[model samples]
Target: MGNIICSHSLSPLSHSTARCHYLVPTSAYDVFINHRGKDTKQFLASSLYDNLQNRGFRVFLDKSSLRVGQYVPEAITCAIRRAAVHIVILSPNYAESEWCLDELYLLIQTGAPIVPVFWKVRPSEDRMEDENGVYAKDFRKHKKAGKFSTETLEKWRNALRWVSLVEGFISEG
Candidate 1:
């Protein structure tokens, strides 16, 4: 990650270690990291967050950026909207979470720059092939679950397709 300079004017506390002050809805973020908690929250996501923060970038990692009493959905949505760039850590179980897919869809809809990190998963795995593919199987499961509407599922598929086409980093290990 090079010098990630966002257009927003930096707040006085932007480089401070006190992260809670930046959780306000009006605060802008340089980076919004999206990932499955079970997959990469403990290690990869946290490491990336640290790296970005250390480099003086205001980053929003759900676990670290969110306050104890804040509304999760609203906070996440606000952060996504205010973020200059998004780093999606696409792990093996990434497509399994509806929340993750929803975030991905929203991020894409924002038309903001997204840096996809293929962590332990190939870009080919996200290609929504009809017969057999990682994302395809996940969507099939979501369809069978009867919770998500067809349109929503299709949107997720489209998001995956679009993101997979973008040039991104690959982390095989």
Candidate 2:
């Protein structure tokens, strides 16, 4: 994508609060990035955020956009809704985090454009249901612990399957 020039200026509402104010904005962001922080925060996600920002895109990356003491769920939901596009980075342990799964479900619900980046994992691996599959193992643990309802777990699985079908980038590293 080429550099996008946004007419509206985005300013922080207050240093003490985690709210941002936009001027006559149709959407708050050109892109919203969803990723497993532990997996990609130090490298891929931060690099992508910086690159996109340098290219003049209004990107919402949780680590950069969110403030201290911010209500995480609300901030994430708002950013997702206001983004024109979403980029979901599917790391090896992506499905292990309920927060990541919930974010994926919400991203699917919005019906917005989504770009999935498979990092060190394949789409087929993501959809695997065998005992040896990492995703399957994590989900089994979730089920055993009763951390999420069966219906919600099903929805997460469906979300993964749906995203795996979408045309996306694959990174061996």
Candidate 3:
């Protein structure tokens, strides 16, 4: 096997145990897609979820489940805890939805490595003036402050493999 250089140090990890010492690869994120169910059109337009599934990711999407009223939040929260990556599909309507906002807060506060996919919205300061723009504000904080670097797009593809399973976009039930 080729020598794998640990990102933390120049020295290579001869043993598998040493490889685990540094931060794990971004691929550890089991993708959790946070979008308004009412905006399925936007989500489908991006095809981000499908692309992730095609790359062999276990994607947790609400469309597949036959969830009734009252229990949805619990189920969604459970999914959030299990996710390695949370992909927020931000739109004008997205900012208005309390569910979307609450989910964003949870994801941000949890310190999970987030990969925001801006949809029909630009990342700008004006959009973040109100607390409704919390997601945008957080993005700006990370980007302008140089706290976040432009991560490679390949990392998103690699993260799919961490999912437990991927249900096809359309479910029989």
Candidate 4:
């Protein structure tokens, strides 16, 4: 190949090794579906998981493996860590659930690529608030109860903002 532009400095690759620096993709479960259990589990998430599984992907879905006595949250965390790619189905009620937010925070922390699929919502309206666009109203409810830490709440907020900005697939339903 001829001289290619250096992605970092916007210069030519004739004398740079930048072009040779390739990122190694993460390995493990081929895909992880992060979605609200009640909102999309029976529909969107399941359909996506089914499609991917049919195509020979090692998919991880929280609903399928939840344990009764064991720590479910920890199990979910482990699944996220083992997933190569994540498909986050962003539904209207996504940000409300504490468990969902926790899973999302972990996904963000992983720094792995996430496929944010908008369901019944758009970026213009994907706002994490208590009484506004895309209301994560549960945050307000949980905050009042004082069950979750301030740091965890903040982390969920930040993660929501990041996910909202990520460009991904969208659906009318």
lDDT of 4 by residue, 1-173 (tens): 21211122311112222322221123547788998888999989888888998999988887765557535544555666668898888888886776677677777777889989989877655556336566456667767877666776676777777888998999977
Q: For each candidate, what TM-score against the reference?
A: 0.84, 0.84, 0.52, 0.76
Model 4, poorest ten-residue lDDT window? 4-13
- lDDT by residue for model 1 (1-173), tens: 11111112321112122333355544479999999999999999999999999999999998899888876765676687678999999998998887788778878877889999999877878886545866778888988987777776777788888889999999976
Q: How close is candidate 1 to the true structure, as a TM-score?
A: 0.84
Candidate ranking under lDDT, highest first, comes to 1, 2, 4, 3
- What is the lDDT, from 0 to 100, of the residue 7 in candidate 4? 22
lDDT of 3 at 93: 55
Question: After superposition, which runs of candidate 3 have C-alpha atoms over 4 Å from their true positions?
Answer: 1-29, 40-46, 65-70, 125-127, 130-173
Q: Could you tell me the lDDT of residue 15 within candidate 3?
A: 16
- Of 1 and 4, the candidate ahead on TM-score is 1
What's the CA RMSD for each of the models? 9.2, 8.9, 14.3, 12.3
- lDDT (CA) per prediction: 0.78, 0.77, 0.47, 0.68
Q: Which ranges in model 2 have alpha carbons more than 4 Å from their true place?
A: 1-26
How many clashing residue pairs, candidate 2? 0
Q: Tell me the tens digit of each residue's lDDT in model 2 across 27-57.
A: 8899999999999999999999999999999
